[model samples]
Target: MSSVPEDRFRRSPVPLITHGARRTVLRADDGVRVEALYEPSPGGGTAGPAIVVAHGFTGSLDRPAVRRAAQVFRQYAAVITFSFRGHGGSGGRSTVGDREVLDLAAAVRWARSLGHGKVATVGFSMGGSVAVRHAALYGDGSGSAHGGRTEANTAAHADAVAAVSAPARWYYRGTAPMRRLHWVVTRPAGRLVGRVGLRTRIHPRDWDPVPLPPVEAAARLGTTPLLVVHGDRDPYFPLDHPRMLAGAAGDRGELWIEPGMGHAENAAAETLLTRIGAWLVAA
Candidate 1:
C-alpha cells in the first residue's frame, strides 16, 4: 500500500477555483466592511440553490478549514464565504455573536443579489448562533423582539438554515472550552490574547440587552428548514444544546449527532458535508 504524500496534507498552492469565484467587500448594516468570496457552482448557474457559509469565531474566509468547506459546498450550489467584522480584512471589533448577525445578514443579501432564487445559510459555532438569530429575525421579514423591521432585515432572509456546534443558551460555563471562551470574552488579558494571538478582536463588553437565545430564535424560525448538527464529543457544548435547538425547531428541524466528531467545520467529515450540501440543494 502506498502512503499519501506529506505535502498533500499541507496547504495547497493553488486556489480552490478561480473561474467563477468573485471576491468583493460587503458593508454590514452597521457600516462595517466585510470581506467576502463567492464561487458559482461547478454545474454553472443551473445549480440548485446558493449556500452562504458563516465561519466560526476566530475564523476568516482565508482559513484553510473554511476554504475547504466552501470547496465542498461549491460542488452542489454557489457558495458565499465571508469574514465577520474583526476577522481578516473586515473592519471594526467583534461583539462576539451580538452584532455578528449583521455580518451574516450582509453575506446572505449578497448571495441573494446574485440572482439566486434560493439562499441557504450554513454556520459553524459562533457563526452558527448568528445564523440562527439571523434566520429568526429576518427569515419571514419579521422584526426581532429587540429591534424593529428594517430594509436590510427584510432583504437578508434565508430560505434554509444549518447550525453546527452552536450553543442553545448563552453564558454557559459547564465545559472547560466554554469556560475558557467566556474568559476570552470577559477578561482584559484574555481579550488581549484574542486580539493579538488569535487575530480576533473581541468586544470589551457584554451584550447590552442580550440577543435572543438560540433556542428562542429556533422557535421563531417558523417553516424555514433548520438542521441542528453537533458532535457527541464536542468540548465547547454538550448534547443538551443541540437538543434544545432541535426541540425549538420542532417539525421544521432535523438533528444529527456525529458519534466521535469533535466540533464545527474542523470536525465535519467530507461525507457529512456532502449530505449537508444535498440537504441545501433539496431545500
Candidate 2:
C-alpha cells in the first residue's frame, strides 16, 4: 500500500462547530485519515459517557442513515460517528473489515481524549464485525491486531459493544445479497460499479494473515459487555450469525432477535435505536 500524504495528518485548528456538532479529521496510528463528528448530549440526561457509532458497508458519516442514528443516540449520551477507512472523507482503500479495526480504534481513542469516562460502540453490518473485533483486540490484555501499537490502551478500549446485523464468519456467500456484495468487492467491473454507483471504494487485495472472525473475537471479549442483535427478516445474514456470536460471548453477551426487523441502520427503527441507546446508558 502507498503511504498517505504527510499533509493529511497535519494538525488543523479546531473544527468550527455546526448544528451543535463538531466535525474533525483524525489520523489512525497507521496514518489513515479518518473523518469524525462529535455531538454532545442534547440535554442533561447523562453527561459522562460517549457512544461511538460505526456504519455498515457503503455507508459514510455523511449518509442520512448514519446521521439519523447519531441524532437518536445523542438523546441519551454524547455520540461520536465516523467514516471507516476508504469511506467518505477517510483516506485509505477498504480492506472490507480487516484493517478497519484501526479506523475504529482511532475514533474510540478520540472519544476518550474528549474526556468521556465511559465509551461504548454500536455498529451495523460490516461495522458490527469491526466493533466486536475492536473490543477484543483493544480490550485490556486481549492481544493486539497491530503488534503492540494498539495493545493495552485502556482509553482506546470500548467499555461495551453492540453488534447488529453482523456476520459471524468471513466469505459467506449463502445469501443473494452477500453474493452480490462479494461481486462488488472482488470483480474489477463490479468495483467500478461500486465506485461510480455506490460511492464506495474497495481494495483489490485480500486479507494477508486474515484477522480473527467475529465469533472468535466475541469469545475473546473477556469482561467487556456484548450485545448481539439480528432480525428474522434480515436479508444479508441469517439468525445463525447472531446466535453464534451470542454463544461465543457466553455469559458476557446478550442476544436480541427482533421479530420484523430487516437489516442494518437503514432498516433500524427509531424505537430500536432508542432501545440501543438505553442499553448503552445502562451498560
Candidate 3:
C-alpha cells in the first residue's frame, strides 16, 4: 500500500464520535495518526477511571457496536475509542494485528499518561487482540505487533484489564487459503515496502509463523483480570476460540459463553453489557 499523501492526513479535525463527543488526535512515527474519542464522565466525577473500547478486524471507533460498548462503559468510567489507519477516519493502512497494536499502545499511553487509575480494554475479534497485547505490555513490556513489539501477550497486567471476543490463538490461523493469502500479502518484497515498513499508507500484514500469538502470550501476562466472551455458534473462530482464550489466561481469565452467538457479533448486546460491566467491577 502506498503512503497517503502528507496533505491527505493533515485534513481538518473530525468529531471523534457522533452526538457532540470530544476528540483527540495522536500521531505515531512514520506519519501514522489515530483518532481518540473522549466522552466526558457523567456526574461531575473527576477521578473516574477509563476504559478503552476497541473494534474488531476491519472496525473503527465509529462502529455501532463499539459506540454502544463505549456508552455502556461510560456509565462506569471514562471511555475512549479510535480508528486505526485506513480503517475509518484515521491515517495509514491496516497491519492486521501488527502495527495497529502499536496504534492501540499509543491510544493507551494517551489515556494512562493522563493519570487514570485503572485502564480497562474491551475488544471484539481483532480488537480483542489489541486488548490482549495492551495488557501484556503493562507487566513485562515484551510485546509488539507488526514485528515491532510482538504484542502477543494476551493476559494483560495488574493495572490493566482486558476483555476479548473470538480471539485467534495462532495469529496465523494456520489454515489453507488464509495462510497462502497472508504470505502473498506480507512477503515484504525487497525489505522496503515501496520502501515501506507498515507506515507506507494502509498496508496490512497477516499472521507470521514467527514468535507467539496473543493467546500464547497470555500465560506470561501475569494476573491482569481478563474476560473471555465468545458465542458458541461463532461461524469462523467457533466456540473453541473462547476455550483457547480461557486456556491462555488460565486462572486469571473469566469466560462468558453466550448461548447462540456466532462469529464476532454480539447475539445479545444486553447480556454482553451486563457481563462486561460486572467483570469490570469485580476487577
Candidate 4:
C-alpha cells in the first residue's frame, strides 16, 4: 500500500481535450455506494465505445496500475473505473466475486446513463471473474446462476467483455500466487492483513451458494464478444484458465496468450491494452 507517485502521470489544472475525466459515486443495487472515475473518450465525447474497468484483488481506482490502464483506455474510448464494494471508497465487504456483480452492474448502468450507446467491460484477475459473471447474468437478459432471471439481470448488460488473468474456476490453489490468495480469503489473520495492508476487505468465509464459475458464465455469454487475455508466464492460474474460458465462449471469444506477460493489469503491456481497445471498438 504505497501511495501513487505524483510524477507518475502528468496532471493538468483542467482535463485535457484528449481525455476529459470526472469523478462520481453511484449506488449499487443493494444500496452500497461505489466510487467511480469517468473519463470521456479522447476529444470530448464517446467517439468509440465506452469502457468500464474492473480492477483485480487488492486494487482500487487510485492504484497506479489501474490508473495506467485507464489512461490508455481513455485514448481510445470513454472509460469508467470503479472500486468494487468493500474496496476503496465503496461500501460493504467483498463477497469475493459472488456479490461483486452488483457493483459492475451499477457501473454499467451509470455509463449508459451518460449517453454512451455501446459499453464494454474490462476486468483484471478477481475483477475479471466478476466481469464474466456480470456479462453472463446481466448481458442478454439471461437468468442468474442462482436460477431464474431477475429484473436486475435484464437491465444491466455489456456490449462486450474482456477478462484478463481471470480464473476459470474458484478456490484454485495450484500456483504459489493463488495459494497465497486462498490464505488471504480463508484465514482471519490473512483477512486482517488484506484489510489493513492491501486495503482489500474480505468476506468471512466461502461463498454460500457458490455463484457460477467464470468458465460456466463464459459458456452462457451467447453472442456477446469475449476476449480472454492471459500471459503464458502468468504465475496464477496458468494457461488452462484462459483456454477454458475461450473454449466455453466458443466462436464468440478470442484468446491472447502473451509471450512474456506475467499477471493482471500490472503485467499487461501498452500494445496489448491498445489492441484490447481496438477489439472493443470493433465489437
Return the TM-score for each candidate structure. Answer: 0.93, 0.91, 0.74, 0.90
- Candidate 1, pairs of clashing residues: none
Candidate 4: lDDT of 182?
Answer: 81
Question: Taking the tens digit of each residue's C-alpha lDDT, what string does model 4 give over 21-124?
Answer: 67889888778889998888757485457899999877888876778788788777888999988899888888888888989988988887887878999999
Query: What local distance difference test score does each model get?
Result: 0.85, 0.84, 0.60, 0.83
How accurate locally is residue 107 in candidate 3, as Cα lDDT from 0 to 100?
69
* Candidate 3 C-alpha lDDT tens digits along 14-125: 3335444578887754468888887755762436677777776555676555566676676677777888766777887766666566677666666666656566777677
Q: Encode model 2's per-residue lDDT on 60-113: one tens digit a residue.
A: 887766777787888788889999988898998888899898889889888878
Candidate 4, residue 10: lDDT: 41
How many clashes (backbone N, Cα, C below 3 Å) per candidate?
A: 0, 0, 14, 0
Error of 2 at 245 (Å): 0.3
The 10 consecutive residues of candidate 2 with the worst lDDT sum are: 1-10
Q: Which stretch of 10 consecutive residues in model 3 shows the poorest summed lDDT? A: 1-10
